[model samples]
Each structure stands twice: as C-alpha cells, then as structure tokens.
Target: MAFNYRRIIVKIGSNVITQANGLPDLQRLEKLVDQIAAIKKSGTEVILVSSGAVASGRSLITVSDKNDSVATRQLLASIGQVKLINTYSHLFEQFSILCSQVLVTKEDFRDRLHYLNMKNCLEILLQHQVVPVINENDVVSVTELMFTDNDELAGLIASMLNAQALIILTNVNGIYNGDTKLPGSAIIKEVTAAGIDFSSFVSTGRSQFGRGGMITKSTIAQKTAKLGIAVHIANGTADNILLDVLAGNVTHTRFVPNKKASGKKKWIAHSENAATGAVQVNEGAKLVLTSTKASSLLPVGVVAILAEFKKGDIVKIIDERNKLIGLGLAEYSSDKAREWAGQKNQRPLVHYDYLYLQG
Candidate 1:
C-alpha cells in the first residue's frame, strides 16, 4: 500500500501504552513497535513522542508515604525512563532498526537557539536512519514548565520538522460528538477550517493515565493543522493503527492542513508559549492583521508595550482587552517599541513574515 506522508510524528499517549493497573503494557508496545518498524522500512521518516515512563517507573519502585506527589513523580520518571527506552530499544533491535532516546523539557524549546539545536539533533538522527524515541524529561520538568501532554510536544515536533502529518494514538477511536460511552455519539471524521466549536460536544475530562484530555488534543491538532500539518487522532490499541492511518484504512478524526504556510510561520505558530514579551495592539490593527490581506504589525498600531524583551525575542500581541492576538518575533527592543508606539511611519514592530495570527 502507498503511504500518504513521507514524514510524520506518532504520539502514543500514556493511556494507550499502560495497562489498567498503571503498568507498562509490554505486549501492546511490541505490536506498535512492529508497525513503526514496518513504516520506517517503507521510506517514511518517523519521530515518536511516547508516554509511559511514569507507568514504567511505577512498576519498578514503590514510593514511601513521606514523598509528596511531585517527589513521587520525579522518582518514578528518573527510574522509569530507563526502563521505557530500553523496552523500545530492545523491540526495535529485533528488526535490526536502531533507535535513539531523546528526553526534553519545555525549557528546551524556550528560545530560538535551543529550538534550532534540538531540531538539528533530530535531523542528524533521521539522516543516520535512526528512529528517535522522544519523551518529556519528567524528572526535571516542574508542574509550571510541563507540556500539557505528549500531544503538545508532538505538535511542536511536527511543526518544527515540517512534517506532512501527525498521528496521535489515544485510547479512544477518535473525537466524538458526545460522551463516548453513549450509544448514538458518532466520531467526527474530519475537521477543516470551518471553525467548529468542539467544546459543545467534546468532554473536558482528563485521561485515566495522562494529564490532558480530548480538549487538549483537539486544540493542539487544530493549531498544528493550521501550520500545514495534517493531524490524526485514533485508537492506539487498534490493529496496525499507524499503518492503517497511512493507508487511509482507519476511522479517525483528521485535521486538514492549510498546506500554504511557510516553515518560519509554522515555527512561529507554536511559539506562543515561548514568547517573552507582550504588546497590546489597537482594534484597527487587529482587524487588518486577521484579514485575508497580509500585513505587518506597525508601531503606529501598537497601543502599549506590556513587557520588556530584547529585539530578537518572541513576543505576544494582545488586543485592547488583553486577549491574545498572535505571536511574532520583535524587530526592536520593547523600550524602542514603546518610544515608537502610535507613531507614524516607524519600522514594523513585527513583520508579516514572522507573525502568526490566532483565531
């Protein structure tokens, strides 16, 4: 069968990789590894963002009552990461496919330099025909710096690499119109730029073993798709889920891609969290920026500089009510931007090429 995408990100959620008792499900992992190996042999580059370290860690050690939740997690992640990566390494070894373990925290992508460095490292691994098995460095990531879940990390990786698609394997078949347990609730097969409000039907409940829920997946999927990467959410436990997704033989929710976005824009799309500065723009600027016509953020349209940042830092654009408008790379220091705010004919604070508007 012909594969649809030459490059893809596969994110396996904790719920899909762990058993009911919160232990690593080795049998299920082996099956998924077999499928990934087959996909790699078919000439497609695969980057895996997997979750199961905590579950794997839980199996190896029991925490004392004196340890708090954070301490417990750190201990588990420190120990479990080794077990999880080793399982992946051993499984891929059977097929003569080499895999590398990549652990990262939100801090890794906080700045442009760090982001590019990580990207370069992954590129080298792929060039050497090594599958990169990535996971969050839970041992070091505090609650404030943690990604919403592996789904968010996967989206970032997909956008960073300009992947053709992102396939998120969860416990559920796909996003549904109502509670999944209800008999009549149907899966929403495809999502486009139609501005559908998923919150009306999708539940906000977290997964049994994961931090995020369907809401987080849908949000990240939409953002990733807007950056020109198609996204698929499907059941990881299904037979040959990865292969079926690539072959168009699976039932899942797909977020259609825009396909016209530039690589820089894709990177900017995910930089909202990495932004260090904030600027509130006038309504006039917001309207033009969000319009079909491309426009740069001019100093004349800026109302206030809300934070201090260097010229090259990523900044958040807000509206009169302090609502986020988008994220962009600043062309000047916040001090300079403030001096020129509402002034005429100043250099654009953020050029259209580096700006990513939000909905």
Candidate 2:
C-alpha cells in the first residue's frame, strides 16, 4: 500500500485505547502496535504520542481519596508510565521492532536550544529505525505546565519534526456537524479553511479518559494545519483504522495544509504562551505587518515596550488595541527595544523570517 506521508505522528487518545472502566485494553494496544509495525516495515517513520498511563495506573493500585487530584495523578503517572512503556515494548517486540520511550514536559520546548535538542534526539532515533513512543512527563507536569492533552503535544511534535501528517485516533469516527449521538448528525469530511467555527455543533464535554474534548482537538488541528501539516482525526476503535485513513478510504475529518513554513516560523507558531515580552505597535505598523508585503518589526513601528525580555526570547507583538498580532524571537532585549522605540534607522526588533502571524 502506498502511503501519502513519509513521516507521521500518530496520537492515540485515552478513550481509544482504554476500556469504559479506564483500564488499558491489551488486545486493542496489540492490534494497534501490529499496524504500526507494518507501517514501519514499509519504510514510513512513525512517532506515537499515546495517552493511558493514568488509566493503566488506575488498574494497578488504588490511591487514597485523601490525596488531591494533582497528587493522585502524579502518583498514577509515576507508576503507570512503567507499565505503559513496558506494554508497548513487549507488543512491538512481537513484530521484531524497537520502540523507545521519550518523556517530556513543556519546559523542554521553552527556548530554541531546548527545542533543537529534542528534535535532534528524536531524529536520531528515527534514523536508526526506532519508533519513539512519546508521552508527556505527567509526573512532573502539573497545573499550568501541563499540556492541554496528548493531542496538543502531538501537534508540537509534528511541527518540531516537520512531519508530513498527524493522525489523531479517538473513539469517534470524526468531527461531527451536530450532536454525535443524533441520528441525522454528519461528520465534516474536510476542513480547508481556518475561520470555520464548530462551536455551535462540536461537543464541549471532555473525554471519559482524556482531559481535552473535541473543541481542543479542533483548535489544535486548525493550528497544525495552518503550518502546512495535514491532520486526520479518525476512529481508533475500528478495524484497520490507521491503514484506512492513510489509504484515504475511510470516514474521517481531514484538515488540508497551507503553504509550507520555515523551521523557525514553525516553532514561533506554537510558542504563543511561551512569550516573555510584548510590544504594542502603532496602527500603521499593524497594517503593514498584516498586509501582503513581507515585513520585519522595526523600532520605528514599535510604539511601546510592554514587557521585559532578553535577546533570543520569544516576544508577543500586539496592536494598539492590546490584541495579539503574532509571536517572534527578539533580536534585542526589552531595554534595548525601549531605548530605540519609535526611532527610525534602527535594527528590526524581529526579522520577518522569525515572525509567525496568527490567523
């Protein structure tokens, strides 16, 4: 079978791999692993972002109700992670394939250096024909530092690795236009634009075993698609779901990709929350930046420095209305930006190549 993507990131949602009781389904996991192994053998590189460590832990030991939710989660992750990885290892071994466990937190992508380091490590593993089974470091990731879910993490990984496509496996077939349980509701097959809103039709309820619901998935899908990466949301519970989606013969929602972006811009695109400083630009500057012309953020365009940030730090570009325009890597510190604000003939605060404009 011919696959469209040479490299792909597959994210298996908790609900797709767990039973209603929130326990790991070994049979389902084995079946998925077999499919992944076959794809790997076909010379397609795969990176799996899987959830279910907590669910796996839930079956291993009973935690006291006295512990807060966060503590209980940490405990579950710490214990369940071992079982999760081991299960993957054992299943992959049946097909004579090697899979590596890669645990990461949000801090790993906080800066360019850290981001590149992670990219290098994963690339090396792929080069050696080793599949990387990546998961969020749930033990250390707490509260604000945690990823929205594995879907968000998968998007970041796809962007970082410049994967050709991202396949998100969930319990449902795809994103529906109305209530999923409704008889007349139908799945939206293709998402070709970013401005399309599904708020009126998409369900907001979180998954039984995952933190994020369809809303979060749609948001991440749009963001990933904007960066020139095809995204597929399909049902994992169905037989041959992965292979069928790859073959384009399945009922799933696909987000078409835009023009490809550079590596720096791709990183900047997902670093909205990582920005440490902000710059409020004049109306003229905002207009020029948002226009069709290729432009850099210059000191003359910057009307005010709203926050402190060092050189190389991610900074937010804002308009006079205090609305975010985009994110970019700062060429100079905020102190330097302040000294040169509204001054002409100064170095650009952010180069066009490092800037990422949001839709």
Best by lDDT: 2
Candidate lDDT scores, in order, read 0.92, 0.93
Model 1: how far residue 6 lies from native, Å: 0.5
* Model 1 residue 285 lDDT score: 92
lDDT of 2 at 132: 97
What residue runs in model 2 are displaced by over 4 Å at the alpha carbon?
1-3
TM-score of each: 0.98, 0.98
**Candidate 1 accuracy as TM-score:** 0.98
Q: lDDT of candidate 2 vs native?
A: 0.93
lDDT of 1: 0.92
lDDT of residue 132 for candidate 1: 98
Q: Poorest 10 consecutive residues of model 2 by lDDT?
A: 1-10
Total residue pair clashes for candidate 2: 0
lDDT for each residue of candidate 1 in 271-358, tens digit (9 for 90 to 100): 7778999999999999999999989999999998898889889999999998998999999999999999999999999999999888
